[model samples]
Target: MKYEKAQEILPQDLINKIQEFMDGGYLYIPKAETNKRSWGDSTGIKKELNNRNNNIYKDFESGMKVDELSNKYYLVENSIRRILREHKKSNK
Candidate 1:
């Protein structure tokens, strides 16, 4: 989000009221609760990571070691382990 001048957007009375509480600081106006999007939902990052984790599990099942998967995916060993564990739990 970009900063818009209060004078340009807010009514004079509203600006004055805001200034009374905060002299010249930034004010954040959040999006409505109904309009909120979860992290990565709009960017498709969640989908990408899901695909990646699925591939990782496939490779693990096909006899690829955790360390090898980590190196191939450029993730840490612990992250690979967590992914495998989560996949196992999901399968169960």
Candidate 2:
């Protein structure tokens, strides 16, 4: 989200109308419903995580210790265990 000046884009009358209720503050305008995207749709974070999780699962299958995976991935031991569980569950 970038801050756009009303004076730069909006007409003076519209700006005045908005100012009647709000003197000077930030206003958030959301995208249209049809234009909305699911979480991680625009960014590749979800895809990256899926790939990483797959790698972790593969490493675990290849005899990597959970603690070693935790250290390599910088995740908690429990989190690595949970990821392994999730992968196993999904594979089934």
Candidate 3:
């Protein structure tokens, strides 16, 4: 986001109509609902996290201990357990 002056974009008549309700304060307009993107859609972090969780679940299935996974991923034991649980739930 960038702040754009109304005069630069909106027509004078439209600005006047808007001014009737608001004197000079800034107004925010949001993007259309259908055009909105979910968090991490642009950065690919969501995908990366999903892949990592999948690997963790697979490792656990292959006899890897929760403590070992916690150390390998630098996460708390509870977080590793939670990720495993989430994977199991999603598979169903």
Which candidate tops lDDT? 1
* Model 3 alpha-carbon miss at residue 54, Å: 0.8
Score each candidate by Cα lDDT.
0.96, 0.95, 0.95
Rank all candidate structures by their TM-score, best first, as comma-separated numbers: 3, 1, 2
What's the TM-score of each model vs. the native? 0.85, 0.75, 0.89
Q: Taking the tens digit of each residue's C-alpha lDDT, what string does model 1 give over 37-61?
A: 9999999999999999999999999
Clashing pairs in 3: none
Encode model 3's per-residue lDDT on 1-92: one tens digit a residue.
Answer: 89999999999999999999998998999999998999999899999999899999989999999999999999999999999998988889
Clash count (model 2, backbone only): 0
Off by over 4 Å in 1: none
What shift in Å separates residue 33 of candidate 3 from its native position after superposition? Answer: 0.8
**For candidate 2, lDDT tens digit of each residue in 1-92?**
89999999999999999999999999998999999998887898989999999999999999999999999999999999999999999999
How does candidate 1 fare on TM-score?
A: 0.85
Best by TM-score: 3
Q: Candidate 1 clash total?
A: 0
Candidate 1 weakest ten by summed lDDT: 1-10
The lDDT, on a scale of 0 to 1, for candidate 2 is 0.95
